[model samples]
Target: MTKQTEELKQQPGLILQPGPSGWWDSERVSSPCVLRCADGKWRMWYYGGDPHFDREINLPTGRCGLAISDDGVHWERVKGPLTMGAVFEPHSDPNRFDAAHVGVSDVTYNNGLYWLWYFGGDSSFTQVGNMRAKGLRMQPGCAVSADGWHWLRLEGPYRGALLPVGESGEFDELFCGFPKVVRDRDGSWKLYYHTLHPEKGFLVGLAVSEDGLHWEKAGQVLGPGSAERFDERGVGTRHVLPIGNQYVMFYEGVNNSGYHCIGIATSTDGEQWEKQDGDATGGSVFAHASSGSGRWDARAVGTPCVVPQSDGSWYMYYIGANEGGSDELTSQHQIGLAVSKGTDYGQWKRWGE
Candidate 1:
């Protein structure tokens, strides 16, 4: 039987802070993708943005970044080998789909190849948002890498999004991005993402792909919370893990109060999901430490990246913030880590804490 994960905990010891005051990543680093290679080395791909530019533009100033770690806990940024500007590709032409900004949220490796799914900012000339939301008609871009380090992006429709936003009145009418893609046992690709609903702040949606490049939307998999629930405002940035014929998805949830926490849901088919909530906490599976501790993530948590460690254990890489508790931050954001004993996926502890 698949163990029902009751909770995921956070520790204070594992944290990767922002870059120095003058560096490109001085403000925040989020949306981490961790891959454990056969050689036992850990490589991470994350996005960084200037807090000032993020608020000034009212959008994600996300620039793709890289990090390497011998052990999952210790880390160092890739300065020279990564081409300091952008690892994948950046928006240059205003006519392109990702003219404003670009950020990579999901990545996969199989048979010595790497597949990346990135989210692009609003278009330069067109209107892509829905009646409720008005921002970049966010979409997913595809890229392949011979090695996890170097990449070659697609062009034309191949470079375009795997699944564009839904038509009028669809669940993903406003915007859809933050892809969490994985291959099922049947060799089909299952892509999960978060989108803005007309009434719901943000929701989770599913798409399927036959070749990891071509995709088709399935529908909304998860929705917002009740008026008084923790995820009442939104549920964004999901990470899906397949375990024993059941799939577990970890999501970033926002309440009406704008408090961001981690939530979990379970699915049997990867298409339908049931929110796993706390009877007392209103379904929040994971929460930040008390603000009194002055922890880096006291304010909120989002952008979950879950990787399976050797020896049957697991590691989760996520971003944390202590101010303005939503996805958009007025303050700094940092990277944090959590660990799970190989015995159970439902239980987690702060890495090295």
Candidate 2:
């Protein structure tokens, strides 16, 4: 049975936290890209940062680290050979697309090889009203790995990126970030990425690839929810899983009040998506812990990484923020887990619950 805490609900699936060595992930660890193989060993590739790391971007991102787990609950960090124990970092050249910072969004093992799809930004700074933000021109990039540690960059047209931002007067002209890829049944590929519109908030765009290197833009597919809905604000990092004959997308949505939660959407062709009505928290199948619960995820939860189990259950590894963190950007982000009740995708319980 799950243990209850006073009147506040607990986030029992809260397993991995930030590293304590004050190295790379001492301040915040987020964006979990977990892969569970046939041998039952779990490998999670996540991005994190320390306090003194990039003070200009406002988002907690710099380098990515790796963690290993036996049961997918308890995790042990691997001492990587990169800087500050990071498995991957930004490019060395200032003219590169990922020269500033990088974050892994998808890690797929196909035909005895691992394909890592990530998003990165340059050091160019842009002044938005009163604040100065760096690395706003984010773009998608790709890399391949044999041992999951050493990687070789598959350079794209836009300075090591698979796709570039949209042209003038386009929806994604602002930036293209957080790329997630899914292989279709016909051996073709679909790359899903997002961009922030000044008026429409955040919208998800698609691009199809034949060889997973060259891509063609497919326009926007998913956007913000209805008025006063959980995703009324916008959509963020998401994962698309092909289960059975249909495709399911677990995405992050931001409300009007800047609170983030995880929402569900279904599609038959993987291009046209329909948002399913969520639980009590508007359109979110999984919501953040109550604000007064004093939990690690009291403030917000987003960036879902869902994995299916053999017994029909599902595991969703996500990033959460506490009340102490300010507006999504300056928050102290951490990683946690949530489990669905049996095969009930709409109903979920934090791990241990």
Candidate 3:
């Protein structure tokens, strides 16, 4: 996959879409995070659900909104979201663990405040194995926010699951969700998430934190591949970039026909990794978009968020899906973008496709 990752295929385009009637993403919008604020303005935190679970639309377990953009491709939806309305609701003190539902998988602003990482589901995955035949569990949480729109759960409201869940048959026990963090230079903190590998599917794991509120695992750095390749069957929603000293993971792979693409791995100390090969299925640098077949996100793409553009160039907010016949998968998914400049900024190209 050279010619610069095949000129970076599929070329993502739709910037952010999903919402039009009564708001709260009317029907979709999945994991996205973009921040570039020091007053320069440009903030975004995403997640919009009700993908037809339709419990009236305002409370069905998927919230995490807040948008604003001076040019991150036109956005503006600051009408309130930080989960003040409850969707998954519960937590009425039923002995906590996110009470019953909560899914907000990435948001970080370290040291000064604002840090949220989530995935808590006590049941209700609709259909599709009901979280593994009703024994139900999907935990991996943490919360805190001083100004990023009000949030608090460092240990209280539903007691955010810090990082610990694998026991019975372990590999992250039963489930874990998307979380990709980085902070090293001695300050200590480097997480990367995605678990549920009782058989080598959905892999990516590694944990360690110093003050971001306790965490320590440090087990699997990345996994799932070679069952045919292209991410063999599952790899995990991730996003990490720290170019200079190494460490650049922008994941979400999944192939074996379950679709999903976008890959790249490299680590110097973030705990050993290397995936960057070529063609036929040699460590995809990016996938999905067999020419965007019928639009609205050709068919599958990962949840990767990369932002850094005060002029230095690089913006890659991702989450795209279309194959809605099965009622769409991955939390309804939608939101896209891609760009790069000086030095190729990691050679992406789906913003004008």
Model number with the top lDDT: 2
Q: Between the candidate structures 2 and 3, which one is better when assessed by lDDT?
A: 2
Question: lDDT (0-100) at residue 53 of candidate 1?
Answer: 45
Tens-place lDDT per residue, model 3, 261-335, is 777888888788987654423357656667437665566777888877766788888887775544343434677
User: What is each predicted model's overall lDDT from 0 to 1?
Assistant: 0.71, 0.86, 0.66
The lDDT-based order of candidates, best leading, equals 2, 1, 3
Segments of candidate 2 deviating more than 4 angstroms: 1-11, 327-329
Model 2 lDDT tens row, 107-126: 99988888889888989996
Model 1 regions more than 4 Å off: 1-13, 51-55, 80-85, 123-135, 156-159, 278-281, 324-329
Clashing pairs in 2: 13-351
Candidate 1 RMSD computed on C-alpha atoms after optimal superposition onto the true structure:
6.2
| Candidate 2 Cα deviation (angstroms), residue 51 | 1.6
Clashes of each: 4, 1, 5
Better of 1 and 3 by lDDT: 1
Clash pairs for candidate 3: 1-278, 1-279, 11-350, 12-350, 61-87
